[model samples]
Target: MTLVSTATLLQDAYARGTGVAALNVITLEQAEGTVLGAEQAGLPVILQVSENAAKFHLDDPGPLAAALAVLARTSQVDVSLHLDHVTRTTLLHRAAECGFSSVMFDAGPLPYEENVATTREAAWWGHEHGLLVEAELGYVGGKASQVESAHGDGVRTDPDQAREYVAETGVDALAVAVGSKHAMTTAEAELDLDLVARLREAVSVPLVLHGSSGVPQPTIAAAIRAGITKVNIGTITTIAFTRPIRQKLADLPALNDPRQYLEPARTSVSAVVAEMVATVGLAGTQRS
Candidate 1:
């Protein structure tokens, strides 16, 4: 299959009441593993490159983006590239040229008016280039700081405000703070399913769930049923990819070759992706 657009995938999922797995990609192996896992499940997947991940690769996303583009173009199942949590306008501007079909312009932490202004401009530019633009509404905490209680702290998005924000920003998707926190190693976050349903009814576009790695599989499925169209998973994938490598290194201290460990790590990622796809009820939902 050829590389597809994220808007197309999300629209289909939104209409079908299913969720699409948008797994974070930090390396070539991770990107390959994502596609392999989606192919294994016969479902479409989005390869998301975060702003931090782009900075990791020498502050330029072009090389990694190019590799992902090639991988998606040749993949067995439908695949879309997305730039996730991009705070810089420059990066948003460069997203289409980098072969990304969608971008999440994160301005949620800023003042409400500022977030609206920036996101609106980003959506306008993204539309001009045929890119699916996504933006965060409420602050989904815990990526850079200590994990906050998912249900407390006024972090959850307001349904009424979300409706206005979407209309004001014209974004294609909205990432809301339900209960999950970023970088959580444990799957204990309890989502507010009622809020999810309310937000779904509040906005016309698809709703995105960030920090989904912290939510249990059953809960994820329930959230999807409640109206989460896109699920952004990162921490668990990194944990899965890193644990095996650590174990291998501990078992073979003198192993100098990278492939010996990276191969198993990639396999771990593939397994996680497959499980996540099933969790989202997207298994065997491949499109022609």
Candidate 2:
């Protein structure tokens, strides 16, 4: 299959009432594994590269973006590249040039008015370049500190505000804070399905659930049923990839070759991706 547009994929999911898996990729192995897993499940997936991941590659995302583009073009399953959680305007502008089909302009940390202004500008640029733009409404806390509430009582996205924001910003998708937190190591987050349904009814675009790594499989399915069209998963894949490598190193201290451990790590990530696809009820489903 060739590289596909994220908007097209998400629109299909939205119309079908299914959620699309948007898996994060920080390395070549992760990208390959994501594609492999999607192929295994016969599903379409979005391969995401976050701003943090770009910074990890010496603050230059071109090489990794190019690599992901190649992987997407050669993959057995339909794959789309998404630039996730991008706060910098430069990075947002580089999305189309970097082979990205969509970008999440993360101005959620900013005050509401400022967030609206910045996101609107981003959405305009993205549309001009034929890229889907996704923006967040509130801070889905968890990456900075685990102790913080995943669903900050007053920080959850209000359905009324979300409708206004989507109207004002003209974003193609909206990521709302229901009850999931980022960087969570456990799958115990309970989502506000009512809020999800409300947001879905309020917004004109597709709904995205970030911090989904912490959401249980059943809850994830429920969220999809309630209205989540895109699910962002990262931490779980990291855990899966690292656990096998840690065990492999502990069992064989003499294994000095990177490939020896990374192969299993990659396979582990693939398993996680495939499982997530199934959880979202996309496994074995054909992409339109």
Candidate 3:
């Protein structure tokens, strides 16, 4: 299958009523593995490079873009490169230049008015370049941008404020604060279904759950049923991919080559991705 652009995949997901998987890609192996997962599952997946990952790699978005281009050229599945949780205007512009089809601007932490203003500008820039722009409103617990305090210490997104923000920002999607945290090791966290339904009734644009990994799999599916069109899974996939690598390296002290370890880790990422695709896209029958 030809690699479909991010806009087509996202729009198709919205139209088909399924949540497309947007997996975070950090290292070269991760990108390859995500592409493999999408190919194996026959689903179009988005390769998301978050702001932290951008800085982690010395502010070089080039490698990730190159990696996606390689995947797009070679794979039989559709793959879209995306920039996630970006706040800096300079970095956002850089990602656009590097061939990102979409960017998720996280202005939720700032003052309400400022969040709207900056996000609007970012959206305008993205629209000018024909890129899909997603803006987040209301602060959720355990966002990576926050420090010194963890989840449960953060503020929840008010439904009215979310409506106002979406009305103000004109974003393609709106990430709202429900109950899930950012990086939970366990999958026992339950989402506020009532809150989700309320927001669904309140906001017209698609709703995005920020901390998806912490939420239970069933709750995640229910969130989709509750009208969430985009679900982001990062922490769970990271833990699933990394813990085994840690163990494999620890067991084999002389293991120096990453291929010996990262190969099996691909299976871990694929397993979680497969599950997400199966669960979220249950009622979604249309395919591009």
lDDT of 2 at 136: 92
Q: Which residue pairs come into collision in candidate 2?
A: none
Among residues 3 or more apart in sequence or in different chains, the pairs in candidate 1 whose N, CA or C atoms overlap within 3 Å are none
Clashing pairs in 3: none
What is each predicted model's overall lDDT from 0 to 1?
0.89, 0.88, 0.77
* Better candidate number, 1 or 3, judged by lDDT: 1
Residue 153, model 2: lDDT of 63
Give TM-scores for every candidate, taking all chains together and pairing residue i with residue i: 0.95, 0.95, 0.91
Q: Taking the tens digit of each residue's C-alpha lDDT, what string does model 3 give over 1-288?
A: 655667787677777767777788788777777677777677777788998999998888877787777887787777778899998888888877888888998887887788889999999898898778888766666755653232354466678888887788788888877777777778776777787778878877777877778788778877876767777778878887897799999999999998889988887777777776566656344422
lDDT of 1 by residue, 1-288 (tens): 879999989988988888999999999998888888898888889999999999999888999999998999999988899999999988898899999999999998888999999999999999999999999988776866323565667678999999999999999999999888888899998999999999999999999999988899889988888889999999999998999999999999999999999999999999989888877855223222
RMSD of each: 2.6, 2.5, 2.8
Provide the lDDT at 14 for model 1. 85
Model 1, runs deviating above 4 Å: 145-147, 283-288
Model 3 segments beyond 4 Å from truth? 144-154, 283-288
Model 2 TM-score? 0.95
